[model samples]
Target chain A: MRNKEKTYNEIVQTAYVMFSEKGFDQTSLSSIASEIGISKPAIYYYFKSKDELIKYLFDKIVQEIQSLTSVELETITTTNFKQNLYQLGEAAISHQEKDVHFNHLFNQYMLLASRDTYYSERLLKIQQDFLNTFYDLLTYAVKINAIKDENILIKSQLLALVFDNITNFILTDMKLDYKKIWIEAVDSVLSGVEHHEQ
Target chain B: MRNKEKTYNEIVQTAYVMFSEKGFDQTSLSSIASEIGISKPAIYYYFKSKDELIKYLFDKIVQEIQSLTSVELETITTTNFKQNLYQLGEAAISHQEKDVHFNHLFNQYMLLASRDTYYSERLLKIQQDFLNTFYDLLTYAVKINAIKDENILIKSQLLALVFDNITNFILTDMKLDYKKIWIEAVDSVLSGVEHHEQ
Candidate 1:
């Protein structure tokens, strides 16, 4: 059973790389199987179709993100609010970049998912989960008086967008260092919004 | 002469629509001509090829944006920072929606352009123009004491990324109302970063 699960994961990872490089419509199951050095039947046994394969990959990504957030939140319990938020941002960006296939898969997934209703709901749930984490952080900061009280919804949404922009910038290979860029953005957000002692 | 120019403009507009609905690679000159009710030769008369058509369309977009920025900068001499910045963000989002084809062309262009050196220079120039405009705005704001004097390069880059996100969100048909969302984002940047007098 463990061996079967490992093979399934390996196939998904290989499929993600091909899908990102060639696009969904362009990638073929045979090519994926060939790349993985696995038989077509083996892939079919794991995933009924290419669409199902992509969906499974998406689910795994969401699960990984959920786990990452939970772990980070648990570790940051004693840290200052600003440091905690910065760490979260760094972790999210780092995780996305650590695997080249991750950003490509994410961009492709988002572009397709946005247009299709069936996929959009699933995508929205993933987005909401991520946003809820940020919202909780903001709410905590406000409670701790580390940040000013404003509209939490708008604030959370804005922070989410900022992070989105950072991710896109990195994925696009923009001629800027993302680490420096994101760190500065976090500082700007923290300093700009925090209640300053007059 | 005026009639010929109008006809050419109509052809370009029709091509933009078709290209946006059907992606650039998926679109052909024959189809664009058919949509415009013109012969294939007629399209060649206006644009020698599909690449030429894309270049023409991109140049027109850059020109339109440059003109808009110039007009806005000229009119707002007093530097009412927040209002000016808000209006600029509003203009950008509205312009994007009005020229929906620009977004489609841009997305396809990014994928294709990234692989070809021929398109890279033109793409880079467009990006540079955008960055310069944003930097100018940030500089003006800082000079007028509307925003804190900090690293304009990083802030400008972040602002440009936000603008790109707004355009992407609109193109993706995301559920959030862009105008309201942009207003909130701009307000957050302004309010968070400004030196508040207690």
Candidate 2:
């Protein structure tokens, strides 16, 4: 069992590198097996086909990203909402800084999403989860009488869009101070809610 | 001369259809020529290769999009700033509504941008132009005493990010009332500057 799992991991890792370099369509299972010194049949034992391999790889990538930067409700407080968001932005920046090829991988994934329902659903889930995090933060702020907003849904959705946009820029390797940009952008949106008494 | 121009246009239009349906990498000059009932060398006479064809196509796409939805400085008034923005958002929504394959072509172009400097520079120009439009709008608003903010640069950047994000969602075929969302999101960000006198 240990040997089987090791081979599976090696195949996945090799495939990731190849896909990132050559893109999903251009990379082949034969190429991955040759790169890993594994038999082609061995990969089939792990993943039925290239499609299955990509799906599995995508799920793993999303899980890694979620663990790295997703908001934790328990760590946030009503009064320090802006501070907590700043931390979220910082985590995002660090993730990008650590991985130079992440932007290419992400753009490739987005292209896949445009073609496949499975990828599009995954993309939507990420967007939905981001919006939900904002909804929870806003709810906590309202519960503590820290802010006022009649359109929480739209506000959270907008915040999620703004956050995703900035992150997209960071992922695309744009030469900008993303952390500063995120803070300034968040401040502009949050300021409207920050001072409202009712 | 007229026949030459007609054949050139046919090749471009046919390539556009094939590329939109099958993506850039999967589509080929031979396939495009066959589709248009022309010889492969005829396409070569107009475009040197697939790379050259794609570059030309991308340029045309950008030009078309710019003409469709880009903000016109002459159409704006300092007093009705938000209304002018709303009109801009409306033009964006209408553009998406008109073309279903635009999002896929855009995703393909973005994927190309990741691997090629030419595409990335084009993408940057679009983003920079968007940011500049916001700067112009905000400058006008401030000149007429319609809004006030010390961080116009950051504000314009954030607004551009938000606008681009919302348009991305629309292009990706997200089922939502985008115009309503655009208005609400813009309202939240703009409200911060609208009420501040200094």
Candidate 3:
């Protein structure tokens, strides 16, 4: 039983590297097993197919994002909420920016998610998690009287758009002009979230 | 010669509908030929393969966008700059939004664009065209003293971001919240373009 668990995790680790490097379509289960020195049938016993492996990877990414962002958000003080927000924004973009191959694999999954309902719901869950995270963070600021009673739900969604969409859009092209666009977007979002006196 | 051109155009039109309906992977040359009542070889004579046909359809979409937006942009007088921008934005989004199947095909092409440099350049041209159109319109307002000497380049790019990005994002799901987000984004964009006193 212990050996079985070891082999399962080993397969997951091997498949993640293979999938990120070769992309989902190009990387096969046989290739994954071959790289791990396991039989193809043995790999299938763990992941069923590449589809299941990708689904596991999606969950892993979401968990990683949640944990990583949660750690960052917890450090936000009332005195530096705005500054922290900018820092968090930079961190999020840079996190994805640093990993080119993983970005490619991640992007391909986004395209596939639209075509498959199972993936679509998984994507929706990731989006909902992000929105909820941002909402709760801002709500904390509001509760502590650090910020005004802002319409945070809308702000969160729009800010997520600014964060995720711009980050995703500028993934491939990181020219100065593109970076300017991204920074301009995040700055605009930060300012927009401020409680303006009407 | 005239008859040959007519047949070619008819094939193009038929393939567009079929490709959008069935997606590129599922839609084959034989299927297109059967739908158009032409021999498979004749279709192949015009287009080497599905790749050429897809390329042709992309060019056709670009032409349609230019003609469509040119007519809209020409009507933007100084008095109605903001409202006209709204109208133009809505027009562009609704134009693509009207055809659901085409959005799938168009989005598939976008995914492909990231993988293939040739398609990437074509997609970049579309983005540049949109930016140029917005830049020209905003520049007109600036030249005529309708607005301040705004950073038209950044404004144009950001507004184009709001226009095209939001337009593309809302293609799949036009829920009430999504519409609100789109309007929220555009409104923020318009307000952000204003010359703020330092």
User: Best candidate per lDDT, number?
Assistant: 2
Best by TM-score: 2
- Every model: iRMSD: 3.1, 2.3, 3.7
Q: lDDT for each of the candidates?
A: 0.70, 0.76, 0.68
Q: For candidate 2, what's the TM-score of chain A, rounded to 2 decimals?
A: 0.84
Tens digits of lDDT, candidate 2, B1-198: 999999999998888777876788777778898899988999889888888988888888898767755666665666577898887888777877777567568767877777688888888787667678888888877877778856777777777777778777875555667787788767766776785445
Summarize candidate 1's per-residue lDDT along B22-55 as a digit string, tens digits. 6665577878778777778888887778888987
Over 4 Å off in model 3, which ranges? A1-46, A68-78, A137-140, A146-153, A174-183, A186-198, B1-23, B26-46, B67-75, B150-152, B172-179, B190-198
The CAPRI quality class of candidate 2 comes to: medium
| Candidates arranged by TM-score, highest first | 2, 1, 3
DockQ (0 to 1) for model 2:
0.54
Cα lDDT for residue B17, model 1? 78
First chain of model 3: TM-score? 0.73
Q: Highest DockQ, which number?
A: 2
Judge candidate 2 at residue A103 and give its lDDT: 58
Model 3, A1-198: lDDT tens digits are: 999998999898887777765556667788888888888999778777667888988888767767756635566777777666666667766776676555556655666666677767776666667767778877877876556665666656666566665555564362426455555654555465565556
Better of 2 and 3 by DockQ: 2
TM-score of the candidate numbered 1?
0.76
Evaluate every candidate with DockQ and list the scores.
0.34, 0.54, 0.33
